[model samples]
Target chain A: ADTGAMAAARTRQAQLTKPLGALGDLEDISVRLAGVFGSDRPHPHGVAVLVAAGDHGVAAGPHPVSAYPPEVTPAMVANFLADTPAGLGGAAVNAIARSVGARVYVMDAGVNADLPPHPALVRAADLGAGGRRGTSDLRTGAAMSRDEAEALILAGAALARQAVQDGTDLIVPGEMGIGNTTPAAALTARLLGQDAAAVTGRGTGVDDATLERKVAAVRAALARGGSDPADPLGVLADLGGFEIAAMLGMMLQAAALGRAVILDGFVEGSAALLGVALAPALADFLFAAGECAEVGHAAQLAHLNLKPMFRLGLRLGEGTGGVLAAPMLLAAAATLREMQTFAEAGVPGGGA
Target chain B: ADTGAMAAARTRQAQLTKPLGALGDLEDISVRLAGVFGSDRPHPHGVAVLVAAGDHGVAAGPHPVSAYPPEVTPAMVANFLADTPAGLGGAAVNAIARSVGARVYVMDAGVNADLPPHPALVRAADLGAGGRRGTSDLRTGAAMSRDEAEALILAGAALARQAVQDGTDLIVPGEMGIGNTTPAAALTARLLGQDAAAVTGRGTGVDDATLERKVAAVRAALARGGSDPADPLGVLADLGGFEIAAMLGMMLQAAALGRAVILDGFVEGSAALLGVALAPALADFLFAAGECAEVGHAAQLAHLNLKPMFRLGLRLGEGTGGVLAAPMLLAAAATLREMQTFAEAGVPGGGA
Candidate 1:
């Protein structure tokens, strides 16, 4: 597609009756989309969020820094459904989605335990509904087979397409997999061409010693996979979790369907990198919501050449950052769609 | 006056299921008020914003790096009413007032220009409506007479009382004086028990040489006025703007009326120090919105021992910071007012 549409959108966005570039990177996203779609008015509709829940295998080993056993993943998932007080569950997401009018769906991509029949949980797993009891043995073998990776991607695309058919126009990809940051780190290393140490940090506030171990584990996994940075699918099959692969597919499908996708924190950024790798054109549909304060997030964003709208030092990874950033997105969209242009409002533009 | 009420409020705020202290200082303010007023459910209904517009006499002299010619103050005030496309006019306070649903009133305490009649402008001057054009030889003479200082305070208090009668539950004191940062720095130095050099900083990004001159000018003014740190009223008469005096009165009246006040950035914080100096009890009603990033805001916040809710590096000094913070206040209030207790919700409070 010609970049004229995006350029026009940029012009329209700039002509809004506010300080130029004061709304921050949100203005950038809105204008870029305007140009991409060749529409002065770009409406964000059909908003959907994908929450991927999984566990880490390394937690089975004794670690002084690791808090809570891997069993907490399923328990938290149940809390999300039951609305338990103890759970850091989906309440924040539920409240934010309601506030911004977004539909949310939870995907059990690789949770160790079988999720009982629930309305919120969609069985979108690719590895035959169940995986190993704990985290994937990434050091020795593939996280999931190529077939499993393909299934997950297809399921995510199908879900996104269904959302579009159901009158949804925007997709926000979120993840809920424990120890998922490990895969995210490895993905960042491969995509950004950085060492594992550069991309690895204390996940969930690990101490210095445990951080070293986590970095070593990620380095070992990268070596075991013999991953090719140029081949995105091979990287996913080897190092990316079901959730990351699914998110990447959802992003690509959203772009194909001409829907906007609000990319969440580091894990979602990893998925976006993969999506851009698959179809470089899909990058236009994605908006970097905010920079995750996680050590690897900057590396991932730099790799993709994307800037986030806000910088509140957010590192929580349950799509919370995306939801927090929704207000800015709404403000940008409102500015593009509602604010009067200079020509229409009769406000003089800079020396035309 | 018992601290237990404040303690109970803090406990209630902490138990509301959000991250511990994530809401920051606003939570502290709400909890402290719950104790002061002896009510678990405190009301924030009486709100008033005082914008004091003034000019600095020192700016008329040879200054090396001042972007604005002192005449810009009145011109900008007029621009504020003109509805310019650049948004360079009208105080940011106007937009903030609209955002937070607060009643805004502009007071011309001491502008160098002869003002015309405007519906929004309240001509409550310290030395009568049309006194000497700006301060008289402040480097040699007194900044304002004690009577004028008292009148400014009365004007602020009178506005507060009117708002209270009109059913306002909270008051937000704001200012809009150009070159007022000079007086604010002197006031901060006195209250913080620091030297003028320690508290003084470059206002509006002045160069190092100009900053040194500004610091020297403030020191000369302090020495000339014999400004007493022990007596806030004496300091106000010698080295304060009409707006700061007005804010001091407004804060005292709000405390007397049992209403809460959301203080703005550095300028407002300087006024708050004066208010607290006049009547220590007034501190109970004053909530420091946050430390302003502009020159001497940190010193003022430190003097008050107050913490603001958000730190966005804001220094736009038109009550914008305080207005932006109103949403957080609403959030804190809503969390306390709407959230159900464990007993009411039939949920276990970690005892299970």
Candidate 2:
């Protein structure tokens, strides 16, 4: 983040035709956007939504942590590209992305099944080699090798770099992996030194029995994985899914490229925890999109010291919250760039 | 609200490719929209922003409750129509309205000065007869005659009816009257049966002294006006600004025409209180855009049982919050009308 641009944006905000700080989070958002773009007048033109899909091992076994079957992962990946009358894909993310004029890029980070070729689908081959099709069960042992986690993160960074080069100004990192929220809970609990029960939540609206299974799975994963809070990469390898690692990578890379990143919900917030742990400066480039229905999302955002922008009770990931918040960013930037100054408008008495 | 359409929309939401009730307030909003449109797939096309500009006599006296002078009302009204490089008016409301593809209609509900003819400005002549240039000081006596209050509201309804006939699906009622928050706080306190000090806030970032004066003014107004909580029209005539009364009329008329009305902030919420008081069912067509910086806004929203869609800490009214929230309605409708159902996508397990 450029401090000079940020300071300049703040000064500009104070001069706009309203009271100082009257716009609240919007004023702060505009300054943050100015810092990211390194311009006092930042008008972001393109919003890119990256939905990383993978299959979670815990979702495949008996007493699965997820409400939906594991095959729903690949099915939803295909659904992300399926044509609809709305001129977008058939899923929630696609419809929302269309609403925000954002392009959806679905990545097969580590789906259990081979996803068919599609224009909107970013193939696993586009990512580096030695990527696992899916992770091992986190409840029993390490979800994946440390090498695999690193590869997925690098792959995600590569995708974000390409997006920035393609004129995308804002990146919304979303994830779709059945039973992945269990891993996310384990990772958040381990990193934050909290109990599994404290962070674990019902994924996909599971029954009480299934929710208990999820909490138990997270506790088991933390006890067996030998993950360390000081080592984010190791923790990710032990408890994070491929999509989670990819999202972390995307956030780090997008921030490095000076583009703004919006975190979807709990799963994405877990990835953000890892990213922030590795690079504390990453917090400067990220925005928490919503205080989702997930029981642990608020806790994770609180840990990151990032205020959730909207509290729409959204629990569905795949960048739904981020896409919904894109226009707010546009509106904030427009306020800074377009609105006349108090002096320019000849309005008086802004003692603030 | 159409119970049949709402029920059908609820069913459709459950069948969508995500968990039932995952969308939170968004799901509820879509259902409400369905009830208003009488369609399971309700898609609102046009968003019309109505900004009622007026003056306040309380702002002219010594120890004014407002930070800005009364003249700033007409100045900001002109700013609302000033051309900018963004191809919209050079104000926060216009810039935001442009970003959301909403049209801004500035109505001179009762401006102290004669606003020149402009395409964007809706002259007072268009409203109705018996309109006052501004209101008497609420601190001393009734704000306006009963006839004036009734005329302003009826004129507001006429403007709303015109907007709806012109293809507006959503109405955003905004207000721009200097020292207006004083009246709004008084009305909210009177209607909610709360004390003035509890609801009075620093409107436009007032200093400590100005805030004290604002609270004293509200208390004085309530004591002298003798406004009945039961008679909303009488309450308006005694304590409401012209802009606030007009907004009340606009909301009532818009809801009657089956269009969704998004309340801007403190001033608009005060108007909504009156509208809902007159027609309790009008709550079905209303959406609180944000929990604004105003202290009384939450109390007003709580009384209406309308959960705000966003909380950006906005204090500047003129439909900024409402315009910002229009996209959320569009996205909510898109989710209902565009997304594929689980049966259509061949996905399973929505036990919710």
State the displacement of the C-alpha of residue A138, model 2, in Å, after optimal TM-score superposition: 1.3
**Chain A: TM-score in each candidate?**
0.89, 0.97
Model 1 residue B151 lDDT score:
82
DockQ of each: 0.10, 0.75
Per-model TM against the reference: 0.72, 0.97
lDDT score, residue B292, model 2?
95
Best by DockQ: 2
Docking class of 2: medium
- The number of the candidate with the highest lDDT is 2
Docking quality category of candidate 1 according to DockQ thresholds: incorrect
lDDT of 2: 0.88
